[model samples]
Target chain A: MSRLIIPLSAFFFFMAESTYADLFSGEHFNSSRIFVPHFLFIFILFLTIFGSTKYGIIYGFIFGFLFDVVYTEILGVYAFLFAFLALVVSRLMKLVHSNIFIAALISTAAIAALEILVYEANGLIKDTGMNFTEFATIRLLPTLLLNFAFIIILAFPIKRIIEKANFESD
Target chain B: MPQFFLNKRLIVLLVSIIILVALIGFSVREREKLSWPEQFLKDTTGFVQNIFHQPVQFVAGFVENVNDLQHTYQENKRLKTRLDEYVKLKTEVQELEKENVELRDILDKKESLRDFDPIQATIIARNPDMWHEKTIINRGKIHGVQKDMAVITSKGLIGKIKITTQFTSTVQLLSSMDPKNRISVGIYGKGTIYGFIEGFDQKERLLLMKKIPYDVKIKKGSEVVTSGLGGVFPRGLPVGKVEKVESDQYGLTQVAYVKPSAELYDLNHVIVVKRKISTTESSSGAGAEGDDL
Candidate 1:
């Protein structure tokens, strides 16, 4: 159950972000401002902070690969970035004071990095037509706002779950 | 900083970066279709997405109904006036269509570009990433939803099937910023002015139809429809109307901004148009030009 907990919840968040994408798709919803949900990545952040590092990184790789295969045309883009972000965040947490607010900041920054890296990776392959100003105004800001709200709601619960799971693994 | 590189973390990161570059390179290359393993993964994930999509779609449908209610009285009045006019136009269209069929019969023509078999599909998942405009439909190759087939909503043409797995296919919407997504379209009301819908204007949310001869005069609100010159999409599929027109760079030709007839934002059910002629015989590779793998 302990081992299954993380992967299981990761699957839930994976399903969640994709599913909830439909909710914002209404007639009145702002077509220009896009909200991309990274609930699974947020869960991974809590795990990196509260659970064992090895488990956190592994879950990141597994779920990241899943996201790439399912949602995106290209493979390994998210797989590499998700695990890389996990490792980076875990290392950074060691230096900074790790708290709910600080984790929110780190997670937001990590998401920004992830979005830009993916955009740059896309530009490397083909014509991504969108300029930087458009990307930041239309895509980046709304994504951060949505993920930050999710963090505020789910932070304590996710931290408690990861800590409990890690305790059981011991 | 040096201590950060002292451990196996650096090696893992470097090796993974190398692998990522290789994988990206491999995945980005042009290919006919997804592999069997990719097909399987997509199908399984599609199944999960379908389960989650329905309840949310139901709630959204409810919300849309509520929003629609506000304009119902005015819309009803307008539609009621149009209904009487529609009866006369319907008969005229029927007569013209009958005459067209008779002329084609005399010419010994069996199929027209307008003939297509529509495969109904429900959109199960939309790409959460804003970079690309793509939606996953619950129909695939098995259901006659082939790559490069025209996709439409009731309102008008929306997109083409970009990729097909075993049980799911991705519909690349007309709003996609890909330069290769050009479609041969003709504007009516002045004896059919021809041009190609080259790209979309991200800022204004209008499709850019270009390559019109410079001297040709185009009025705003002219009906633009597919010309059937593109082998994949049939003739006379309503694409949009000319919202505005301007000269291209160097003034060699004209560019018209067309507001797409279909509501691209909230897609639920769509039709996959498989043209009979394209299916019975090999296509001419004209429409296949937009296909990127």
Candidate 2:
């Protein structure tokens, strides 16, 4: 059941991120801050902490590639970043306790890196007119806040699920 | 250094970095059509996205309906007053259309720029990475939708078809920062004056229309529409109203800031305007990117 549950739920979280973004965007509620969903990314952070780093990295690469094809139309931007971030986070997991609070703090820092890297990569390729300050205030801040809120809500449940799965990397 | 060369993780990272650069470069190039693998992936995922979007749209529509319920009485009262005028104008339009067909018959003319078939499509998904203003809709090549066709909401023009798979197509909105994004526009006042929609002013939230001869007197609030001279869009599709005008930096031409009539946000449904008469590729200026109509 744990095996069935892990990958399946990660996929749900991935789909939910996009669907939730769709719900909040446009005429429904008008906010200057653009809230991007990093739900799947946060979930992968949890996977690295309590489940298996190996599984986390695999899932990250797959979903990130799907995200590119489905949404951005760019091929490798998300794939390379997601896998790279997963690797970095797994390395950090070696020194850290798996407590919810510590996990939350580390995830916040990871999310920040993710957002900045994406903004830089896209800006370089696309020539987006948004300046650094505008991106920080309008896009980056809200995305972090939104993903953190997602983390706060599901942090405990996800941790429990991953541990119960008892994933073996060695 | 020899030890580093033996590290598996380091080699993997270097390989991925090279691949990333190649992938981004390949995807960014201007291609006539997407490759087969891209088409297959898009169609399959578009199916899933369409499924995800439907429930959300239903709930949104329900809430909108509930909100509309509150305004029903006032709306009906206003619409009642307009009903008489609408009936009168409807007959006039019908009579003019009949006369137009008769005149065309006499001249043996077979086609007009205004002739188009509107295909209804639903929004399936939007660009998750909001760097580009783009949306996916549920009509594509199989549905007769093609690249560069004008897309409109009920309110007015919103965008043009960018890419079409077998089952879904991508629309690039007017607000995109793409330098190649341009549309031929006709500003209607006393006479129709032509220009191209150059770029969007993000701060002012208005479209920049440029290249009009400096001497043409354009009034504030004059309507701008697709001229069909663009070779893709049909004639007379409402685009926006000009809010302000200024001279370009070189002082050879005038620029107008247009506020689009259609709300490009929260798009649920759109019409793909497929022009009936095939137009030969013409160098009508900056608008026609596609070779065939």
TM-score for each prediction?
Answer: 0.93, 0.90
**Clashing residue pairs, candidate 2?**
none
lDDT of each: 0.83, 0.83
Candidate 2 on B85-125: residue-level lDDT in tens? Answer: 99999999999999999999999998999999999999887
Off by over 4 Å in 2: B1-6, B282-293
Off by over 4 Å in 1: A25-27, A167-170, B279-293
Best by DockQ: 1
Report residue B288 deviation for candidate 2 (angstroms).
Answer: 8.7
Candidate 2 lands at a TM-score of 0.90
lDDT of 1 by residue, A63-139 (tens): 88888777777889888888878888999999989888999899999999999998898888777767888878877
Q: Is model 2 an incorrect, acceptable, medium or high docking prediction?
A: medium
